[model samples]
Target: MKKLTAFIMLIALTGCSKLSMDNYQLLKTGMSYDEVTAIIGKPDSCEEALGTRSCVWGDEQKQIKAAFLAEKAMLFSHQGLK
Candidate 1:
């Protein structure tokens, strides 16, 4: 029973470790792709078009999308989990 309880606690803590507003605030316009990745870790996925790229982070319920132009972040937005 103690082992089971410990495992559950570990899972709960891990789930709560997703991106937060503090991490979002670290982003700034003109930051390079590598710089942004260093702050938020590698994006879960990415898309590109016409010299513009958008990277997505976090799970479906709560996520952030950052658009890059010329390999630098131009804008970003976030959605909270519901």
Candidate 2:
């Protein structure tokens, strides 16, 4: 009942946060991290090394990855994460 309804709502909201191709197409090299996040929602995972950062959005079936250097996007890609 209430718990099941709440769970469904949570899943719906989570699905809405996933990245879309329209937003992904808007990404460009040299865009800032904030700009990229604005297009796609917050990343599901992120990692950084040696002043470079990589962020990913979406689930295992589909995902988008953006790499940043100096706080600006240097590379981007999207595909099935599986």
Candidate 3:
């Protein structure tokens, strides 16, 4: 039964179509990090450790790759200077 359910879910996912900012006018590329952050507020999830910042948004990486999707940008500091 679990296998059957999983198979069904896979089929549904393959058949369905998803949309993102590509279909909307609100987001675009080359915008400043601050501008993107102001519009999106915050990322769904983020990692800020060891002078590295990573953010994840949307179910697929491709979606986040779209314009102005990332809401957070980490400024790395080495020896207390960015």
Candidate 4:
């Protein structure tokens, strides 16, 4: 029944927004900022410091955050995504 469960999940996720755990899982270290955006859509806002750019998608209650150094993803974290 794993296949059935997977199919039901796929159907549930079909038209949902890109800001999801699945897309977050797709993020990898060293991925470019543009590539990350291509998967998660544009970040709500971004900040730069110490030559690192930190971007966040969604809001405080539930968000995905990625830190890019030299425009490549160096770190990423998420909050309250199901």
Candidate 5:
């Protein structure tokens, strides 16, 4: 009933997240964090340490991840994006 309908809607909405193969491809090395966020929106979570940062968008099963050094993008990868 209503609960089931809500559940399905939740899944549908999550599926429409900004994290996708197309957006992930827009990433490039040397892009600043602000530039990266402008493309994929803010990350779901991020961690910083030792003058570097790691950020992730979306969830565990479907997500885009980036590693930054000197405040610029150094590497980017994704999981379960389709």
Candidate 6:
């Protein structure tokens, strides 16, 4: 069962990455994108409206994500993707 053992080890290592999101921080209601990025680093995705924006970190595999807001600067948003 060397293959079985290898599969288990792979799963364990993958789970470690998912579990490490506990260290992330949430974006506040009025915080700007720059400030949020400063706290949580760059985001993997983002969304933007006329005067609002949101940034997201992490991916579907990892739930540890953050968001940010901006008024005039370019904003990132998650939309239109199926």
Candidate 2 lDDT over residue span 32-68, tens digit each: 9999888887899999999999998886679999999
Kindly indicate the candidate among 1 and 6 with the higher TM-score.
Answer: 1
Ranking by lDDT, best first? 5, 4, 1, 2, 6, 3
List per-prediction Cα lDDT, in the order shown. Answer: 0.87, 0.86, 0.44, 0.92, 0.93, 0.50
lDDT over C-alpha atoms for residue 39 of model 5: 89
Model 4 segments beyond 4 Å from truth? 1-15
Q: Compute the lDDT for candidate 6.
A: 0.50
The Cα error of candidate 2 at residue 37, in Å, is 0.5
Q: Against the true structure, what is each candidate's TM-score?
A: 0.74, 0.73, 0.33, 0.79, 0.78, 0.43
lDDT of 4: 0.92
- Residue-level lDDT of model 6, residues 1-82, one tens digit each, is 9999999999996565322323332434465656656555666766666645555566664443333334423333322222
The per-residue C-alpha lDDT of model 4 at residue 10 equals 97
Candidate 3 wrongly placed segments (more than 4 Å): 1-19, 22-33, 65-82
What is the lDDT for 61 in model 5? 96
lDDT of 4 by residue, 1-82 (tens): 9999999999987768787788899999999998999999899999999999999999988899999999999999999888
**Once all C-alphas are superposed, what RMSD does model 1 give against the true structure?**
4.7
